[model samples]
Target: MKYLNALRNQWIAARGWMFCTLLLAGLLIYVMQSYVQLSANMPTRLVPYDLHLMEGPVEVGASAGYTDEDYLTEIAVADTQLHSTWTPNNVESQYARFQNRMTPALYAKVGNDLQGRLPDLENSERSQALFVEHTEALEDTVRVTGRLRAWIGSEQVEDRPIAYRVRYAFSDGVPYVAGFSVEEE
Candidate 1:
């Protein structure tokens, strides 16, 4: 009777201890799961980008070669930059006209060409570059042929428009005139 009573008491103690441990473990798991769900539902804060600018020679222009769109863009820019407003009366106006249209090296060459003609500058008018045709000479070079109309203030300078071809290159990271030639066509 004593051995049987001791065995029953030990079994009862072991069962009670196991039940208490299981209850504690379930509570701990529930608490941890609820904390995770609550944090996930909260709104997250976003961080902004930090872009600090530095000073240097601002790199300009597209790459050496051109896509179809790039080729058209260079042609348009070159036309605008090259079109000259004929300043017939003043040396300052003539110089300024070339200075505006041509690059530094180009200006040096064309300036000499126009230097002696400043006195007769008023004999001409502003040139309107009406684009006619373009041919890609190289990967980065374009030969643009166009009709050049001269307008003196409000009047046309001639009865017929002049045809001109300009060889332009974007090889040096910028679209610039390589050569200018006039044609009767």
Candidate 2:
């Protein structure tokens, strides 16, 4: 007991070593807590919650990979019911000249139409179940191939099947389609 008391008295006489030991222990605890939090928040895989963002919709142009000729041909073939004298060559020239002339109204109309169809395509319970099961297997970029039919004035214009590939960036748990292109199938 006398020896232990002597050692304690000597250690207390110095004081600096004891303070340093306490500070180091506190620092170690703080570092360990930060490490745990960082590991907890790290992403394990790409999920829908990782993709939904509210950036403005992108525009489609000739440089988007579809040639003027291709766009003209698609428009013409789709608008067979229209009795216009406009030819594919003429439309191609117009599109070539106005490649950068995308209007907000045009994009809005396309987005509205797409939104309307999404309920039918994406809201099915069966499809959702399938999506849940195999979503990991789906590519980050998706290629959607479909045809669009719209009524222009009194004419029923059925556009040919156009395959579009869209690259999506996942944000906020939803996949937002960011860029699009027409693919030749």
Rate residue 158 of model 2 by lDDT: 43
RMSD of each candidate?
22.7, 18.6
- Residue 117's lDDT within candidate 1 is 62
Model 1 alpha-carbon drift over 4 Å, by segment: 1-81, 84-105, 123-139, 143-146, 151-157, 170-172
TM-score of 1: 0.41
lDDT (Cα atoms) of all candidates against the true structure: 0.55, 0.41
Q: In terms of TM-score, which candidate is strongest? A: 1
Task: Residues 1-185, candidate 1: write the lDDT tens digits.
Answer: 99999999999999999999999999999999999999999976422232245342333345523334445446644553344333345534645554455556666777676666655564655433344544434443344444555556777775444444455545455556655555665
Q: Where's the lowest-lDDT run of ten residues in candidate 2?
A: 128-137
TM-score of each: 0.41, 0.26
- Candidate 2 lDDT, 1-185, residue by residue in tens: 99999999998977988899899999999999999999999986523332457264322332343223333333323222121112332433333222222234433545455435444433332111000111111234444444434333446554444455444443443333344455544
